[model samples]
Target: MTADSLPPWLRQPLAELLRQRGHAWLLQGPSGLGQYELGLALAAAWLCEQPEEAKAQGACGHCPSCHAIQVRTHADLCVLMPEVAMQALGWPLDEKSQADIDDKKRKPSREIRVEAMRDAIGFAQRTSARGRGKAVLIYPAERMNNITANALLKTLEEPVGEVRFVLASEAAWQLLPTIRSRCLGFTLPWPDSGQAQDWLVGQGVPAADAPGLLRAAGGRPSDALRLASQGQSPKAWSLLPKAMSRGEVGALSEHAPAQAIGALQKLCHDLMAVDCGALPRFFEPADLPPAPPRAALARWSRSLASAAKTAEHPFNAGLMLEALVSEARTTLNSASRRP
Candidate 1:
């Protein structure tokens, strides 16, 4: 959706805050839930001298600043993303693929490195590129490691005249408490199930597949739509039931690539959400091909939690997926055996 069509709850308050003329905001939400979009819109509004409504929301879509923000080429707006030095080499990147191609063409580090944070700080401190206030959007803000966070502390503490920092993160709690407290928190709401499902169907997903996508996404429409776009192979889903039900961790490795791990995580998450009385209507049965049973659900809940814990400690992608799959299969098997 265009920035203007952003939900009223977020747009109105943000519009009011920007109108006040000197405020920085932290928008926290699930990834792909419109935090970045709001940030860019706000940046455009800040730079736009003549907004369409003649109010705080001044970045009219027709204006040059709005267009630049939409295209992510604004002169004064600095976007700090994970650096990709090796994109030139054009290595066929895949999951578990983490080797730097070469010194000159090294792929970007998985984690946001300290150097990225430093560059962002440098840009923010420089004179505004367009004589307007400098705007910074640090995506996945928690990606900044401890050293980078420390480096950022100096800038966050002081008021850089005419400069605004917008930090967007899926997991804001991972950030240092001091940094989090410094900025205004804007918690974004996920779209309703209807909106999410409609968005998915509009994107060429068959109506039958919409249910699985919706359930998998937990009513988060954008996420469901994105996963649908990737066209995850059916083998991954086919193996999922058996893995979780029988503790057959190997079942997962047979069919799933590391890329599918994230989707698997969401699937288990959906199972947990559903078991807890929250029906995530976004996932369509056809898209994800759901297999639901009470016993299976309980097993999935127990196994997925344990697997998540293990995955966090060593970051073993294979082990994690296997554990998740095994737990889910065991759960389903138990359900079938139940009298």
Candidate 2:
């Protein structure tokens, strides 16, 4: 769907972006804040053959230009992303790369390859096929390694013809400062709680469950909707804090090792928040056993942060789960006791 068709929570950001002028822009924020959606909308609006007002808002979403983008056939737009991301977005790979991947010669890459950057450079120098110049959209732009990023640097330094660029990133700090310096930056805004809950209901989340789902996702509406749509039941999620407190490894059995660790990380994060006399972000405070001492929760936080680095490739998932839960039990038990 066109960006204009996204949830209403995103409309203000899209409009704010449209009002700005830039040859290149960096849209940076944590995930689920709609950087990718807003970036794509900006590109579509730039290339739209429609009237100026339409350009100043969002794509008409009905023009041939908008339809082309909808179907990924825009002649003057280039999408630079990791092969896996490209595939997921339905962007076609160059013919040779497609062949190699299809023939099992290689797997889709997780990082943007240098070859793809080279192709984009060539795309930049060409005359506009659609007479709207050209637009390059790089998503998770942090995926570009040094060589690929360096190649892109030359284009940003001296933008060719009418070419424009939008770089959307979840981790802006990981990019080269030179790259960051060449573009205007916009930080995505988090929607208000009422706005988030309303959007969640509009996305088909049960009205009664909206608050819990929203809280579980740390107030990111898109993430909350994603969890609801992905079948994360409220009851199952509500039970997590108490289960973890009891060392119930089975409480996390439904998640992959990495996902399980993320859940625990959130759990630890909320416990620390409670210890500081703040409300919990992920779980209902009453659902938690008790807040551990600040010192104990700090250690738990550090341990979980370290575990996150390699949680994806844990050598023994079962052992890791057991150890994690046992630690949880010790910490929670300590919290429940009087000095």
Top candidate by lDDT: 2
Off by over 4 Å in 2: 1-3, 316-319, 336-339
Q: Give one digit per residue, the lDDT tens place, for model 1 in 1-339.
A: 134655444566566656554455778887657665676667667776464467455466666666676665677877654444223222222233344444335655645667767777887778876776788777668877888888888888785667888887878999998889788887887766666666667778877777566665555666666667767333444444444545656545543444344545556566556656675343333333344666566655565455444453446667656555655555545544555
Q: lDDT for each of the candidates?
A: 0.62, 0.85
What value does the lDDT take at residue 195 in candidate 2?
A: 82
Model 2 Cα displacement at 239 (Å)? 1.4
Compute the lDDT of residue 300 as modeled in candidate 1. Answer: 55
Model 2 CA lDDT for position 241: 84
User: Candidate 2, overall lDDT?
Assistant: 0.85
Clashes of each: 33, 0
Question: Which lDDT tens digits does candidate 2 get at residues 1-339?
Answer: 355576676677777877878899999988777777888988998888888775666788888888899899998999999999899878999899999999999999889999999999999999999897799999989999999999999899898899999999989999999999999999988888998888788878999989988888888787787788767777888898888777788887767777787788888888888778899888887788778788888888888889888896799988888888888788777886635
